[model samples]
Target chain A: MSLAGTGPRRDGPARGRPRSEAVERAIVEGVMKLLEDGVPLAELSIERIARTAGVGKAAIYRRWTGKEQLFVDVMRAAEPPDPELPGTSMRDDLVVLLESLRLRGLAGRTSAILHNVRAQMKSSPRLWTAYHDTVIQPRRRVGLDVLRRGRDNGELRADVDLELLNDMVVGPVLVRTVLRPDAELPADLAERVVDTLLQGLRPS
Target chain B: MSLAGTGPRRDGPARGRPRSEAVERAIVEGVMKLLEDGVPLAELSIERIARTAGVGKAAIYRRWTGKEQLFVDVMRAAEPPDPELPGTSMRDDLVVLLESLRLRGLAGRTSAILHNVRAQMKSSPRLWTAYHDTVIQPRRRVGLDVLRRGRDNGELRADVDLELLNDMVVGPVLVRTVLRPDAELPADLAERVVDTLLQGLRPS
Candidate 1:
């Protein structure tokens, strides 16, 4: 399955040349696949992935530090935020980010990784802590940007609390994805959430 | 620990009395203590509990089916929802629910149970489906009710989309609690979320 491409075999074709990319991609893909299939990461293992991906162990270790690093990296790959979209209106920007889920499976990836991350945190507290500060915090900053822009623009009321609004945006998405994979996230949820944040829930 | 306070005591005096509620309470209390002290539930064997509780295995099993069933029941003991606060105001009602985390450790006990549940979901499809439909749905319904109420009272704009609002509320909470346990659910976070739902997040 290592489609290293059918490049011209220059000189004497090497027999069983190392499928280095196959090994890395396979391991990472295997992790994503298991999670997407709802296999919790705690139950995931190189042995199982080897069986699933038909890749060798030596090949996987050659690239990844271990399961932890590999898992974190795989999660990171799924959430590629657009820095270009920021410095704009918060409502418009968040809608763009939130809509990406429909196209790129962001909600699915986020929900899937969560099970794995949760299991890892329970077993390895120190490692999980470091990962959050380094990995998770950076992602959350995207939400922070939206809030800042909203507050700056009169779209959000001048006195709006950024942190609380951040939670509001994040809480529902996190909760919905984890709780019910089948639940739908509409294209307009972000807009409704932002509107509520600025205007208040009371009728005008 | 088996607090066989109700069981017949074979010792001296009226020790042949049935086990007392005090003894049972002591056993459960000991279990919670060990848990808080970082003792793994897997290590909390009946023998260990009985030894710690000064009771018999008979006393423990007499009350519980087995360790897993018993443990599941124990974890299910998250705090019940508080009495509905009297108010037409959404913010006040939410304060009651969000503050209930300390009252129930949405990030603590529920977290632990969810950890175990995620791990076990791999082996038991039935349990996973049951939890998804039962426990998770019930909680999500609470958030949905808030949305529906906002719409009905016109507290939310007539054109507001409720489904999106529900997701906004649930997603972030799960992400915060499951992914980042140390952060407290901020006091004003609910307000921000509610605000976002009603007003658009934009620079007015």
Candidate 2:
């Protein structure tokens, strides 16, 4: 999910001095810390971010446009590279991947970030798109690849729609995690969901 | 979905004169209109709501504690009574119920209201609880009844977990409707979801 190279390039190189990677890292780290601490997006100011990062305002603006871009950059940097699960059985692969999502949702910071971003999405479509493209799309591609393998291996019915199947497999976990954050997801949720889906896709 | 009499009892009868149903309806309608027009929840003030409803400020306060309560009341009032699907078959019943959810998501006002409430849930726990109790729980009970009938009639595996099955059948629609509001649900989505579930549930 790291979009380090994928994000919009900085507008030209720094005018007077070479860009400092340390400062950039500091800024990104600062943003992450603030978000994890439950700072509302509205209150996340460029000045405060700079202060938190121990960087000057000019240093912060040199690499990114504003808080939205900074936030995107921080998330992109923090996102772990997509896991390359070995070609195990589809059930095993899906369970591993979906369980990771479930666990991530349970993490306090990740959960807060997701909730905040979702709340701000309507107000900031561009930021939402950036987050979606950088974070969500890549993860979905991994799930899609797993399903495609199942189809090719004849584990799934030939006519099954991979896209719909992806949604079916992943959607419930997401709904339970986000909409009902207070409720505990079933301990065997990953196993149960995959079983139901695989049962549906098996040749009758 | 109507929770007219199911919500917490109003504190005693109206103290001064009788509560005006027309005024209450007007306030609810005003809330709906503002939300549909895309007014952010932060901007939806009681003063503005009063003006929009063409009722005195005192009229609203007399009934609802504030905007959140009013929102719950309005949604409860506006929500149509759950349809009785003649129990022709589990597939038919689920398709009807799920499609209704899809249609509700497509409706501008309904969609906006759902998003608004979801965004505010973290900040307003009590309102969220009211919504969950009055709106979400009753609908879930309806869905649970359908699944129960399916199990009893031998359309589903006897060992199937009805609660998990309910999430599987309904969760995808919710995820699509809420998370990916921009994407149109496939026209045959309800049929496809129900078909997949039934295929999985059949005692093989």
Q: lDDT at B66 for candidate 2?
A: 65
lDDT of 2 by residue, B39-105 (tens): 8766889999999999988777767766667777766655554567967987789899998888767
* TM-score leader: 2
> In every candidate, how many clashes are there?
49, 0
Clashing residue pairs found in predicted model 2: none
Instruction: Write the residue-wise lDDT of candidate 1 on B109-179 in tens digits.
Output: 45554455345544456545544454455555675686677577766667655666556554455555655
Q: Which one is best on DockQ?
A: 1
Full-model lDDT, candidate 1: 0.56
By TM-score, how accurate is candidate 1?
0.61
Interface RMSD of each: 3.7, 4.9
Q: Model 2 off-target regions past 4 Å?
A: A4-24, A36-39, A42-51, A55-67, A76-81, A108-123, A201-204, B1-27, B30-70, B77-81, B109-123, B201-204
For residues A14-69, could you state the per-residue lDDT of candidate 2 as single tens digits? Answer: 55333466667788888778877888777889999999999888877767656666
Measured against the true structure, the TM-scores of the candidates, in listed sequence, are: 0.61, 0.79
Angstrom error at residue A109, model 1 = 5.6
